[model samples]
Target: MKKLLVIGLLTLFITPFAHAQFGVKGGLNVAELTGRDGESASYKAFYHVGVFYQAHLLGPLSIQPEVQYSLQGGNLKSAFTNYDSQLHYLTVPILAKLTVGPVFVEGGPQFGVLLNADQSGNMQVGLAEDGTPAYGNVSRPATGSFKRGDFSLVGGAGLKLASNFSLGARLVAGLNDINDVQNLSGINDPRLQNRVYQVYAAFQFGGGK
Candidate 1:
């Protein structure tokens, strides 16, 4: 992880001499996870802030990458119960941008490292609507930590606003599982997954030749 961070920072510094552009971005996230059975899902709001750099590779094409701090997770509610979880992560996305006239479309892969997670609300063992105790305790023992890497798909669209600036919005969808909970003596079911979606606005500071 440290090595990846170092390489990313180095790329940021060196790219400017090779037709690179830099920018700042902030955005909103609507996060939810897919589940099995007839269970429904809920959404939670998250936020992100980041810096990015891009290098022009050819006419109408460029390689754009970013480093960001993002918040993601969701709230769960079912009939008589409510539970919420929040997660923080360091995320890196590498994208290919395609332009036509004033409009551009981009898509790429993103990597995330979980920084923290917090949970709250009604959390205990009881008879669920299905006549089973879905969860076994108010607080289960924390198992292994969140893994160091999460994969996601990212894509978006925007327009060039000025000679050296542009604005855009993007959606990030998680493609990797993030559950780390282990066996809880046959009472706890690992039903929740850590998948999320985010929308963001970006402001570019430089342009290519």
Candidate 2:
């Protein structure tokens, strides 16, 4: 993880040094985690802020790479309780951008490292007077840290406004499972999956040169 961060930082610094342009971007994200049963957990609104450098490689193509810290997660409401599962990620996406007149299309893979996970809701440990821990259902534990294959796929599109700016949205989808099974027989429920989807709008700075 440290090596990856170092390489990403170096790339960001070197790219701008080569092209001499830098920009700041901030956007909103609609994020959700999907389970294996084909039912989405829930959708939550998150935020993203980052910096990027665009390096021109050819006439119509350029490499736009960014490093962003993003908040992502989902919420679940059942009859017993409601809980929200949130996570923080450091993501790096390197996109190949194409431009034609005033419109542009970009898509690429994103590498993300899990920073943290949080859960907030009615957590019931034991019974008060009537029932066992039945009525008060606590949210399941989120292992938080991901294993070796925590990277995800990211792709999206946007439109250019002026010569120096653009507005666009992208989707980030995780490719790995989020749970680690210690005891197979203890947990028979199969609605566990770690795939996440995020929709975000990006604001580009500096002219595309």
Candidates in order, TM-scores: namely 0.74, 0.71
lDDT of 2: 0.65
Give the per-residue lDDT of model 2 (tens digit) for 21-138.
5677778877776652423367888888888877776677878888988877777554454667777778888888787887777878878776767767754344557544433545
Q: Candidate 1, clashing residue pairs?
A: none
Q: After superposition, how far is residue 135 of candidate 2 from its true place, in Å?
A: 6.5
Which regions of candidate 2 deviate over 4 angstroms?
1-20, 36-40, 77-81, 123-149, 181-207
Residues 30-85, model 1: lDDT tens digits: 88654522335688888889999878777778888889998877766655446666
Stretches > 4 Å off in candidate 1: 1-17, 36-39, 125-145, 184-195, 207-209
